[model samples]
Target: MQQSAVPELAHTHARPIHWVATATAVAGVIALSSVAQPGSATAAQAAPGTEAKSAPAAAAPPSTTGVTFPLDCGPVKAIVVKKATGDLDGDGRPETVAVVHCDAPMGTPPDGVYVLTRGADNPKPRVVATLVDPKDRRTVTDFALRARTVTATLLGYSTADVPSCCPDLKIPTTWRWNGTAFVRSTTATAHSV
Candidate 1:
């Protein structure tokens, strides 16, 4: 009598599948490790004593110009945000954006978006605007300056009404220079992991 061979054939086929899955997993880990490494350009240059500088150089800043902030918000204990510079006002000069974070009560420090411009005397690097308030619950997660537009990514309180350790929502907002000030051009929100 001839016995069924299906069981033997299935076992042989499953072995190759298992090997393939293991090989794929190993390849994925290698790729992730490469990305996890530091210093691959596109990093953020934070000022001394600021944690923001730790972020990878997120593309070369639009000409440092050696400009400095006029108003010292405080010691930059942490850099919650770092945005590249771009010619926002069409003045042929790039404007930089930085949102600094310092230690304070309620995990809500006096963090503000400092828009820096490299021009003028007395205060060569004067702040164009300081957008911050004591009542805001959103924190700057990331930012990018491109084509005279500044896009800020913010993490805000979740639907549970509690300020969790991690952001539950991501809000991407765009601002454009309207000859005088940066105006909101677009905005959208999504659930963050």
Candidate 2:
């Protein structure tokens, strides 16, 4: 069954980030926009050495796994979180919504996103997916997230380099978050959706 997306940012998933408006992703070399020290999804573990988020955690965090490290992006460089939401699981728990960025100065590299999620058992933050702007047909931005329940951007990015499948069909795809895993929704087969 499909439900309202966790973020509630954009109801539809057909809209993409308007990079031109902000002139944000200027195709520059990737760099560390911000460093988010890891946190324990569980309430038991106190954040002693973890990096602090701009926002404080309310109540208890969900269990989480560790994020993938040393992520290779062919030519992509440092992957960083651009934007994120707090709750996603709908258990009165906050899920993470991260906007990953890549590309920077010379030798910096291209850009990509590193999404993380909190699990119930592990308690450590887990890398959900690393998204890259699909600038080519052979290569498209594929999201890899923990899958607890995710809501992707609806706007077709002006410069995100849309893959053949995304634009051709031009629809929305829902990812179902099972307690233990995530499953792609098959309700709409709009080729793009």
Candidate 3:
């Protein structure tokens, strides 16, 4: 064997102490990396010479709590079955569309859909419009708020002879605000269930 020019280094040989020191250094590097993280990336870039202005926080939709609905439930209290929120009136504030019905013990009670909004003058949420009245004997299903429009599948009876327990007709309906009032438009003809 030929003799090497450089002297044998202690680090060249594998030792328990050397392994422990290397493991400790690796663990320290992992811990430091975890502690130091990059900031979140954003797509929007501010123009030069102009300060970036953060967008104003949007107002929360009106809540159904503490708001009295126009329902005449003799004994049972009115309960909110389903709800959706969106900007309906183009006022930047969101409105809550709630499907409310009497908490009947036996039969399926009819549902009433109401649009609720909180005005600047009044802090409490109030029903601004009644999309579906309970007196109409329609049950709201598949309800949604999309693109400032309220859409729903209305389950109703074809005639008075149809029992309340089962709805025979299904109608897909949508309501949109026209600056004055909410105009209701049925997307499809009523069909048998």
Candidate 4:
């Protein structure tokens, strides 16, 4: 057997008191860690000399239900065919773009594209703009709201002789809020359906 040059230290041995001291030290560290906490996080820092202002809570999009659209649907009730929501006017709140039409028993009813918005004080949604009038005799299709713009494919007749059952002209249209009003623009050339 070979002999060691140095003797073993007393601290190296696992005594009951050593375990109690280690447990007490670990417990103290855990207790101190539980008492300490980090500050709340923020997205952006404010400019110098200005107080930090928290952003307002997000608002829900305007609803189309019970909104009396300007369309004159004789005896039948007007129904919302398609709806999309976004901040159309660069405002903090969202506006709803709804494609509404009469609940006719037969034949293709022309759709009315209406922009609806709810005021901060008013809870009910109101029609703000009429993008497509039902009187134009156009049916709305592929309607959507993207990048603060409203887009839709309008199906219409080229002339009075054209049958209502079969629309001849297809127009890809888009409406954008231009500070004061909703400006209409065509994305592509009109084609026959």
From the highest lDDT down, the ranking of the candidates is: 3, 4, 1, 2
Sliding window of 10 residues with minimal summed lDDT for model 1: 56-65
Query: Model 3 over residues 1-193: C-alpha lDDT tens digits?
Result: 9999999998899999988999999999999999899998988877889998789798888999988999999988999999999999898889999999999998889999999999977778999999999999999999999999999999999999998988999999999999999999995578889
Give a tens-digit lDDT track for model 1, residues 1-193: 9988756655456677788988999999999998899866785577888765244433333332454443344544444345576667886556677766554545554345667765533435556676543235567756777787777766766665665565576767777778877777535556575
Cα lDDT listed for each candidate: 0.62, 0.44, 0.94, 0.93
Q: What is the TM-score ranking, best to worst?
A: 3, 4, 1, 2
Total colliding residue pairs, candidate 3: 0
Q: Write the per-residue lDDT of candidate 2 for residues 31-76, one digit (tens) a residue.
A: 3333444665774554889865567466454232334433445565
Model 2 collision count: 38
Clashing pairs in 4: none
Q: After superposition, how far is residue 128 of candidate 1 from its true place, in Å?
A: 1.5
In TM-score terms, candidate 1 sits at 0.50
TM accuracy, model 4: 0.73
Off by over 4 Å in 3: 1-13, 17-55
